[model samples]
Target: MQPAMRSLSPLTPSDYHAHGVCCCGTPLLQHFHERMMALFAGLHGPETVSASPRGQDSPLLLTNLRLFDGSGAPLRDNVAVRVMEGRIQAILPGDAEPEGAEMIDCGGRVLMPGLIDAHWHTTLAAITQAAAMTADVGYVHLVAAREAERTLMRGVTSVRDVGGPAFALKRAIDEGIVAGPRIFPAGAMISQTSGHGDFRMRHEVPRGATTPLTEQERQGVAAIADGEAEVLRRTREQLMLGASQVKLMAGGGVASTYDPLDSTQFTERELRAGVQAADDWGTYVMVHVYTPRGIQRALRAGVRSIEHGQLADEESVRMMAGEGAWWSLQPFLQDEDSNLYPDAARRESQRQVAEGTVRAYEMAQRFNVNTAWGTDILFNPQNTPNQLRHLAKLTRFYDPLTALAMATGRNGELLSLSGPRNPYPGTLGRIEPGALADLLVVDGDPSQNLDFLADPARHMRLIMKSGRIHKDRL
Candidate 1:
């Protein structure tokens, strides 16, 4: 069952690093070659034991487990889940065993929906800031591929990528060429000149009408647009590039050097342009803004999601509640997971955001705003392992069950805002029949001991995404 062979040239590690395994330096073909080679060797070959069946279309039965359906419902016992064709087929009683199905005894563990990150930067999170700006885009994507595999191992099966050039990575994951979470990509973060998404040097200012786009912009990392027309064009370009949603910068950011934290970036007219473009394509716009003025302006222009509104005043929170907008909050507390900034100005801004995070959670709770959780870990490979710790930090504001539910069901709600542009289709973030098969079976009851999430390697007994088991310790 092998193909024709040829005398292949030998390559060194540095050759592999510089030119990649396939040498063309494209993630798709590189990953595809690796995956196909593995398959040709009998799915992990004669050396290691493959955990579970690689065929996603096969039927899978999980038995003897307590269920946290991610629906904010009470835990149920004595039930088994049936998965078929990458979707939940039924929730049967414990004694009902179907014929000709692969079964895994859960050993009385707890099964819950896999975690969903509402605000994530796929291609930008794991690499250092310096490397991301200067490294080869192909090399950057290879790093992202590794990070994406780690992300799945953390029990996160899906993410709403708010910014970054994640389209190619998404395609690789979808094609089974790589092991990663489902990505709902917003191709780029659109911003005006000197705004938050502008990662240009100070000497590169004074962009004339004929100035060429920066390297970042050319790579679909971020787009710098000035007026309404340009904003409209950029928004459509992202959609044309298979963006599930559009992300626009509406305020200053802590990471950017030129803009102050309180300065609003986009005007209402410009914001309206992006929103309308996304709306025409049956998707919504999510904006990056922190201050009240910026948040209110984005809401006035029909933005559906508000990202990082920690510094928002009570009035702005009220407006978000009135408009029924999704509040995508992240654990930005000045902790070990916080990004390191050398300058005092950025450090001061980080401190202010940390202080506002507590009050922002309180306001969202008080006003009944739809809140979702994420770990906006950027450019820090050392802190990337703290992704689950960020979710566990939600317990500081809510109980264990509530915090887990926020990462599962609540975040799933926010991702569904991308109406027809939803890439994976079917219901997600739930354990009922007809939902996508993304479940995690852990050692203990997370309802009582949320610490199980802090160490997924030893605690997670089994991990399944789209009816295919990626890891199995049972």
Candidate 2:
């Protein structure tokens, strides 16, 4: 066990985040334009960033295609859609193609919103064939590009990256230096000296294998904050670093070797500080928690969401409802051969993470908490060839449509996107007039059946995001 270190920089709540309560409240959001002007240089580049510029139109249109509209609706065939400035400009019915618009026939396939994986690890990479057991910092960059390609090939148009050290890969992917989905990334996670992400030597680890989270690894992730002062500062730094949200270590995790599952690392004050910082920065904070003891403490502190709510009991679910907390309940799809790791403890922990995920989802649904789709897939596809297969197990609990909704519309809502962030209202995950032009043409109807999504390479007939054809037969 790692000895807990005392925090040196103590801070009171009143002095935190320019003094508490968050100036960026829901009501103050009406001043969105002014705030954007003031914060534009910081939010991203100096110029306001949007999907596309004005007036540029789609090069072609689709006609005679069966479309699903991303609403889990019955299919409509022989329709045409026009795109301009990366937004849907028109939708035509009765198989009518727009004049002078290059057209393609769909052969009666299903069209739906580009799937969003709410909680993917954007930085983790695949190990090479020769270095299966090697653990080094160099692997991080390599894994990021590999995973990005895999995700895009799977037809995922967007993803919310929960945690990664430094979040450098996320910026690279976003800058178009790498090919991947649009990423919403959280930088290095906030942790304490002896908390979940901290990987300092725990009583001299056995030879050959070092500590699960090394001090250098701490440099990338493992923001070790102590007391209210440092904790709040760390969270704010993450937000300033372009983190869409902040992730804190609220409890023990399977990835950490020293911490036990029941141990609660963050105090109420620290958690509250984290939340306050995110709120002040116009985003939210999500805590990595499992056991009820730790999750209960987080709920009391009023964080926005919970990640990997494994070991969460019925009471924890009720607490979520009482606090109106959102859940990133990633129901793990199980893989039979995931236990092939040589380290027995590591293998067991991975299995427990999967089981805990399923358990958490079941309880969250029972308590009626607002849940979003999250697929926290960490294992490399090479090692676990069933990477995509495992995710299928997650849908076992929900009807196919509900599962799709959790990943799409609900996920968009969690980001505060559609209405205020977006130029239009009720626009995403639907194909109504003025809705987004994110559509995927699949080989079959996913509303009536979902197995087709399991193998996107074989199933995704075409992928069109913002009317640009990223992948298509035409």
Candidate 3:
């Protein structure tokens, strides 16, 4: 389903100048300004040596390594990879050297494809809920900018951003004005009133015909719509905003305030409206849902991915497999990596999700479903460092190799559902010829011991995205 190519580049004013017209107050000018602000937002960090920019024309080689190609196969020794123009050119013998290439010695470390976070919130991961709701938009973007660099240093080279105002962040990273993972952005989360994405408080209920959108909605964190027409409009708006895929809230959520855990959201017709909108744009819809009824409704409406289906039953899981849907699961074990709750109801909801987490994984495996892994860390900066720890937690249900593959290759496969909207147009999530060069050199083999991933600051010796070295301590 590959469609015509689309540009991820920020808009320039050449058209206006060519036509002898002023570019003030134009969408292109606004977008250009957003990119500039995103670049300036990242200026708070301490000065350090930066790597020279490498584009499609750069020739680089990584040699002397044990390789885990992220294909779920056993590790291989004495292999080297040649990368040029930001993609893997060839896999050669460890001792083979080519002329006119910048070589990086791996020193017998483990070289593997860089990690991919299937369900991430680029603008919402690090900030607290209170800060996110009350802080200035520019301040929020600045915090997200610093977190983006930290996320890359954690060895996550790409992320499927399910929701938030990540368009500017993605543009800045793509332009090389800021350092971050390659972002496949789902512009905003669309939700019905009182649905999972709704952030309205008790006092703001009984919305009028012309009531203004909530603050969170205005910031692109979520969009609240009702009925088929409204849902279709909201879905198309996200697609028009450069969303690779669209996210809709099909059920209740723990982080949200009003919705109960058992509530089923978005009627079949409402969801179908969203599905039709995304499908027309050559992409698909992914929904945040966790109940049997919600899952069934979404699947019936042709949703391609189900996120956070921890509370699903066997029937729901079987239906998911039969429909060939992707299960984007997370390790919500209610331990160090989970977000803390202040109220009793939310805590009870957390316990239920934790209790169902392992069973959900087991069911997906039993049904042979297309399962992927992610760390849905939101509004918890302290737990964000435990992102890799969540991947390690997957070892409870699968072996180390299987767990690693879920985050690398399997997650990459799920991200490709964006089709034409895919910003970085190339193969990802595997160490093979013709794939994008997003890789990591680990101090130890994660295939044998997944614990190496839990401490990226110590074990991640080298990190590369698009064949350019982002962190090299080798």
lDDT of each: 0.85, 0.63, 0.85
Give the per-residue lDDT of model 3 (tens digit) for 50-142. Answer: 244442466777888999898888899988889998899999998776556777778998899999999999999999989999989998988
lDDT of 2 at 381: 54
Candidate 3 Cα misplacement greater than 4 A, ranges: 1-50, 54-56
Model 2 weakest 10-residue run by lDDT? 40-49
The TM-score of predicted model 3 comes to 0.90
Task: List model 1 lDDT by residue over 1-474, tens digit each.
Answer: 221121223322222233335676588877776654443222322111224443276677788899999976778999999889888999999876656566777899999999999888888999998898889887898888878878888899999998999999999889766678999999989999889999888778788879888999999889999999999999999999999999999999888788899999888999999999999999999999999999999999999999999999999999999999999998788987788889999999999999999999999999999999988888888977878989888888887888898999888888888899999887888999899999999887767758888888788877889987777677
Candidate 1 — number of clashing residue pairs?
0
Pitting candidate 1 against candidate 2, the one with the higher lDDT is 1
Q: TM-score of each candidate?
A: 0.90, 0.76, 0.90
Worst 10-residue lDDT window for candidate 3 reads 1-10
Query: Model 1 residue 393 lDDT?
Result: 88
lDDT of 3 at 447: 68
Model 1 alpha-carbon drift over 4 Å, by segment: 1-51
